[model samples]
Structure formats: structure tokens, C-alpha cells
Target: MSGIVTELWPYIVLILVGYLPNEVWRMLGVAVSHGVDENSELLIWVRAVATAVLAGVVAQLVVDAPGALALVPLSVRLAALAIGFLTFLVIKRSVFAGVMGGQAAMLIGGYLSGVSLMVP
Candidate 1:
């Protein structure tokens, strides 16, 4: 038991270090947002920035993927994203449906293109 605990100590510390800051900010947000309006300009700006950041991350992933993802071409990713976005818009912006549709499109496109999704 002592040896096992020693081996896991680094991971435990890492988890705590990673989790504490997010937890602190979450609690702070809850504390300070009690009387804030959802439609406030500040909130709206924050939402927009957050969305932009998420989109940027996705774009980065699509454009410069590493390892197995690098094998998939750029055209296929863009096509998948387009189909997924259209599906999302058509289905009233259901995120689950959008993600699933995108994944399905990628898989089908990969298959038809004779590209293996698995790392060799």
C-alpha cells in the first residue's frame, strides 16, 4: 500500500494542481454572477470570445493535426465540418447531432477515399 501510494503521489499532485484553479474560478463566477444579467454586454462579449476561442481550437486541430490525425487530408476535414454545420443548422443546432454527423462524415469520407483511420 505504501509503495502504491508513493507511485501515485505525483499523479495526485498533478490532479490537484490542474483542478484547483478551475474550481476556484468556477466558484468565483458563481459567487459574482448572482445579479448579472444574461443579456448584459459584458456577458455577451465574454460568450462571443469563448465561442471564438473554441472555434479557433477546432480550426487548429483540423489544419495542423499530429500523429494519426495527420493522415486525414484537409479537404476531408473541411467537408466534414461543412456537412456537420449544415446538419446542425438544419436540426435546430443540436450539438450532439452536429458532432455525430461530422464524425460520420469523416468516417465515410475516409472509407470512400481508401484512407485508413488507424495508425499503422
Candidate 2:
């Protein structure tokens, strides 16, 4: 209804505000990739900033967001991340080990939290 649309329009706009800036970088990366070298200083800075931003977003989601991350407490989520990092460190940065460890922790913690994950 028009009333519902009116109420939600501001939130929709706010979502796009966060979305557009990331898209700009995505488009720029695609546009610039052909001419750039893998070892360029600019590329290194971009990679670092991208990693930091992604980590920050993931931390925020683990701490407060619902859906996938809402099944467990913040402490459990942080523990999972720490475990994943340690697994990566110990295994010489093996991606599969790191991913599986984190996912196992999240799934086990989520199960222990009494959340009905089957519903979603």
C-alpha cells in the first residue's frame, strides 16, 4: 500500500546509501584492472583497505545482525573467528581448514543456543 511504501522509503534510501559507495569501488576495480600490476602500491593499499572494511562489517554482523549470525551470542561468534584465524596460522594459511573450522564452530554454537535453524 502507499502508506507502507511511504514508511519504508527512508530505510530503502539508507540501504542504497551504503550500497552505492561499495559499487563505485567495484566498478572502478573492474575498470582499472586491465592496466594495473598485481604488485603496485595502489593495489596494495586498495587490498588492505578492502580487507579492513570487510573485517569490520563481518564483526558488526556477528555482534548485532540477525538471520545467519543471530543464532549465537557475540562471544561465541568472536571465538569462532579467533579459532578460524588460529587454524589458518597453524596450517600455513590453508583456506579450507580455516573455513571449515569457523563454520563448524558457528554451526555447533548455533545448535547449542536452542535456535531452530531448520525453519529458515
Query: lDDT winner among the candidates?
Result: 1
Error of 2 at 5 (Å): 16
Clash count, predicted structure 2 = 0
Best candidate according to TM-score: 1
Residues 1-120 of candidate 2: C-alpha lDDT, one tens digit per residue: 999999999988877897787789889868989888989999999899999999999888777877856757787788888888888889889989998888888778777877576765
Q: How well does each candidate superpose onto the true structure, as a TM-score? A: 0.67, 0.61
Stretches of candidate 1 off by over 4 Å are 1-5, 91-97, 117-120
Considering only N, C-alpha and C atoms within 3 Å, which residue pairs clash in candidate 2? none
TM-score of 2: 0.61
